[model samples]
Target: MSRPRPRARLTVLAAALLVGCTGSQPLPSTSTPAPVAADAVQDTNPQPRERLRDGGLLRFPLAALPTQWNPRHPDADADARRVLDPLTPEHLALDAAGRATPNPDFVTDVAVSHEGHTVVTLTLNPEAVWGDAAPLTAEDWVATWRASTGQVEGVAPVGPLGWDRVTDVRAGASAYEVVVTYAGVDPDWAQPLVPGPLRASTVASADAFAWASHRDAHYAAPFLVAHVDQAQGLVTLERNPLWWGDRPKLDTIMFRTVQAEAVAAAFQHNELDVWETGTSVDRLQQSRAAADTTLRTAPGTHGRSLHVSRAGLLADAALRRAVLMAIDRAEVGASDLADLHEPPRTWSSNLLLPTQPGYVDQARATGLANDPVRAAEALDAAGWVEGPGSRSKDGQRLLLTFRTPIGDDLAQGEFEVLAGQLAAVGVRLRAVTGEADLTPVSVPVDAFPLARLPEDVASVPAAAELVARVASEVDPVRRADQASQLARLAWQEVVEIPLYQEPQFVAVRNGLANLGAPGYATTDWEDVGWTS
Candidate 1:
């Protein structure tokens, strides 16, 4: 089963091409996360929508075509969530500082009350309507709660930490008014319910969010789903003819799915106007060679970690802990940051990013070290006898694969280092490369940091309680401290091991206004156009 995500946070996305492929999917089903910017976010080329050009085609490249159309579903990757953003209601918008503000287009007013628990009332915008021409109403929110909380059968609620807290959903006065009650004080109440007011009519069944070949959802945003060509691997979005808000600036936005290796070539050949050069020096260099391309740089909102697969040979907790013990995290961190302009820096806690306050080096605090000698001893104690170049236990060789994007030179380099380090400890590593290869042992997380820990970690004693505390804690100081404790538990428990924070690196065609390195700011589709 795919891992459940915490509902209070944004959907976790990979910062690399893994976002599109199977490698990003967790060993079970990958769910990653990013930091919520408590400080100034990496620059996103803020521009006045009025000053941008009126019309142009913004050709965007998605690492892989999005198959899952539902933003709230666990199968939805970064591409799916991003592609769906332009077609969804913006009840709450995250600002540069990661503060949630009510967008007047879909939510006319938001009033919160403290009636013992907590009640949040939302006044729906009468002007907002779905692609099927249904008005945005309270019924939609009620259905969303039912679907999101898994009250409906067969349709799995995407990691429902946020929705699980919702106790009641009913219309206040009219269909336009929505009243919500939560179990406790949720600091980020809007995150879980903001993404959808699922078209209430069709979401009652199991197949509502996903279809086998292609999927499409109802829309209320500035853009309309013009087409989803599964055979062609293209999703085209055009201005909504029924839009009642400000007119969109672009004629259309096309998301073309291409292989990881082909991305640079596509951008250079002018087939794509925007390219996400995910921490790969080779791809970044190649993209810069494109005509009029501008390289946008900012401290990344995402962090990379070493995720251990739960079902493989590494399933033995002792062996899993030994695998982490064998490698030098600092050496791996150096290679990941190599050739980049940002100074070499690695973080130990995924809960609070390095940019946030109350951050701590959980690995050191938990006593995880790069002592291969200790690792070898641990393996020996676990009954694996060390041989010339490998270890064996009951006829099984200590061998594993480190998967990466085929053309990712940076990933390959890191793989080489990881392989060599493990070899010294009598373990052999294989380099596996493919578009959707199944292990992103080293993937960057881009969502709510607190929600990104492997869902299985909750199985550990007090782990579930810690996660709940972190998610519900409203005070910044208390939350950070609670997150610090959880981070320590994640490391000590040998779940997903953190390495460091990555810088947000985006390479886009020059004059592409409002679209580069957005960091914490959500994309404003209507204002994103070329500056002719």
Candidate 2:
């Protein structure tokens, strides 16, 4: 499951702790001149677009590159694929479309053991080779486990949930098997192994695998540690000359950081081949309609939410419920200029199109309905009596602070709308435009006084686990139940109201081919091909 980055927490805290201490600066406009849609010479079967030719340069904008290049590491960022591609990479590597499927660029086949907790076998492409020409092998898997689990020294913790279950990881002739034995029978054991990668041979030895249970510095991916060029803000991955499958189309894949708006503008100017940030939906739609370029929109598993602070009267469930009812999600979505997002019913559901699997619709149906009448009544029942055109309880006025990212225009607009809605219910809603600080009152789970988050599903599981763990009673079943329950509640409470699914948009030159969208596990480099 996708997890939120630690930076997001810091961002929230920074907003709260430093509010009014600093002045808000408007983000520079990176809007681009609208491009004429690239001409589409009718291809009858639109399912498969022609592959791009080799040697073609694909330049795309990135917001930030990861300090760690390895995908298996806990701290790996979404952009890590630019440097290291995982074995059995998921289709549409960066985007979550469905269950991860094999990418032709990496592993050949993945086999799961029948017992469900024992073995997961991955057969690497016989031709697979690292950028440095070392054959990809079983040793890599062993190393990966050691590093991610903190079995080695001098490595950072892979955060809270380190890899501590696997009993053994061994490599066979052409296949590598990771035999995992959890503390107990975990039905979710299949998860950790599906996207397994070979550990770097340079760092830990086979014997180190036995020490995987120890939390040490072996948590960092060696490939990333060795190959990343931090000064240049670039990660260059040279083709594995010995790669078993067809050699990767690009000689070297370079991931570079650029401003989000600049990336959009670059796509319009044809300076970049792909741009992932979803900034201007109207411009993209208009451009595609005119045939300047192919515009493909897919629902993403990301979202945005308005955090409610539990300070003062908001600590009351009735007040929290009232706040939820006062805001109109549909209206906020309507006012959004970029149709890249939609009103999210629950934080558990994917923020983008057609809700996620196992998502329940009760949050939208009953919990957070835009009903001022019900909201006011709930407030009254909770001792918040409306008096002289205001709400109060025991002589204390009902007041709340809504915190959002300071410089984020999109969130600012959305929160402003929410503030106006809450005002009609005799509630004093103050819009605090700054960093989110939750340290003062030990931040309430249901109502965080501060909220700032990226729109990715990777973080969803963590949020869910936090919520479930807080309420869990049984120690043995605490984590599992917490995870599942959090996943369920993400949809149930609409904890983080998602606005839309954002897509990475790339603008390729006319002659480029073999460009398809990358899935959640794969990178853009996988789908790209350069035509003659």
Candidate 3:
């Protein structure tokens, strides 16, 4: 389950290769020339699609990739997993069938200390080289850790303070080692670290490991600062000829940005080889029927929920609860969208694995139910007098301003329906476009008692913690409890009403194999190949 990042505030600004195998069977190619008239064709045999050769080209669809390639920076995660590859990569990358495993492509082995700290040792293919032809080394790993941890200033923006817990990072003669010591017990310590390209010996000689921290000089990963090609609407990726693993199949991975609706059309017309966009159920069903493409469904890290501003009339807890009791969630879930959307039961729907440890069921009982009587009772208790058409409290009108992302048409439609539901209870709901700030007066993630909230509570635990720390009591236990309460309050108060879960749709050309959806926002692009 993934959560949507809050688009309201502008304050915080930011921000892969494969090998060969034994038996060494070549992948069948799918490349073909532009289709010609049936009578004008010379050869009847089907031409193979160009398989990933040492210098072939692959095209991928993108809404946007990161501008910065550095992984340690605060904005790095958005691009690190997709644009910049991870150095100390996770073992088990995706959990599809209850399987937690290591990523064999990048990580060789990992060891954990008694204190629950982890030291990940990485070994790249001997042939692997930096984009600059320098052999990747443990030194590069050390520099990446330093840059991300901000142990050495002048690197990319110092990542969030959470990175400070990394006690030590060292590169050995052979393998790179990263030791992460948590303030408390971190259940997931083996998460991958971003690997940086090796610095030139000349640069290294001048600054040693400190070279990576220098913002002025170009060390490695120059793609971070490179300009986007407006014509292509993409950031072109040239093959790293020095890369150790089997060179990428494509010479250049063309990443193009197109609207979600246009993806299926693009795939049908050969405008794209792969399509990645949040799709609606109707669109997904239509795409799945296309003869020329394959549809892959993966649970995305993006989650969808109704956001309520902490300011305005919604600040009242009683009014918020009244709003929560007015709408129907099941109806929203069933008719929300025609694509791959699911209804969210809690704020952690995107973060907590439903079957994983520490998951509590709080919203199971008070989900979206259409109960005008209960809604009226709650509003009455809050000093609201219900008139024929609307309700008023202390001469103040009961109203709310709802905000959501503009690109999400399905969400926009749901908001319209939700506004109508609230109107029955004498609540005036105004839907605002663009990002609106929802802070200070927000509800918990567990059960929203309020009808609307400002904060976006999704899968990112750190962000959730940040919200919890700021809005609730300050103790750790209390903070965690506050996080849970916020989640609950959102549902219970109907402050932050959940709309639906966004679905990630991947359109692949037929015959592609080993393609997996990104796990927890981390997509391993190296392992996928044309299987034929």
Q: Residue by residue across 1-532, what tens digits does model 3's lDDT show? A: 1122222221111000111001112122232111111111111112222343234345666666554444434454443345444222332343331212333333433443323333333444343344455555566556555555545544543322234545666654555443444443332233324322334332233234332222223323212223357666775655443334433444455667776667777777777766553455656676676776777654444445555554567766667667766866555655554444444322333223232222334456345345778887888888888776577767776766666456766656677777788887787766666544221112222111111124444332344654534332212234334445555544554445544433346766775544534323333333334644
TM-score of each: 0.70, 0.63, 0.61
Candidate 2 lDDT score relative to the true structure: 0.43
lDDT of 1 at 400: 82
lDDT score, candidate 1: 0.69
Q: lDDT at 118 for candidate 2?
A: 32
Instruction: Give lDDT tens digits, candidate 1, residues 40-143.
Output: 46555677876788888988778777777776677888888767778764566555434455566676556654445557777777887877677878888898
Global Cα lDDT for candidate 3:
0.45
Segments of candidate 2 deviating more than 4 angstroms? 1-55, 62-95, 102-118, 123-127, 131-133, 157-162, 171-176, 205-240, 247-266, 280-291, 336-355, 364-368, 433-526, 530-532
Ranking by TM-score: 1, 2, 3
RMSD of each: 10.1, 14.5, 13.8
Cα lDDT for residue 449, candidate 1: 49
Candidates 1 and 2 compared by TM-score, better number:
1
Q: Best candidate, TM-score-wise?
A: 1
Q: Top model by lDDT, which number? A: 1
Q: CA shift at 219, candidate 1, in angstroms?
A: 0.9
Residue 61, candidate 2: Cα error in Å is 4.0
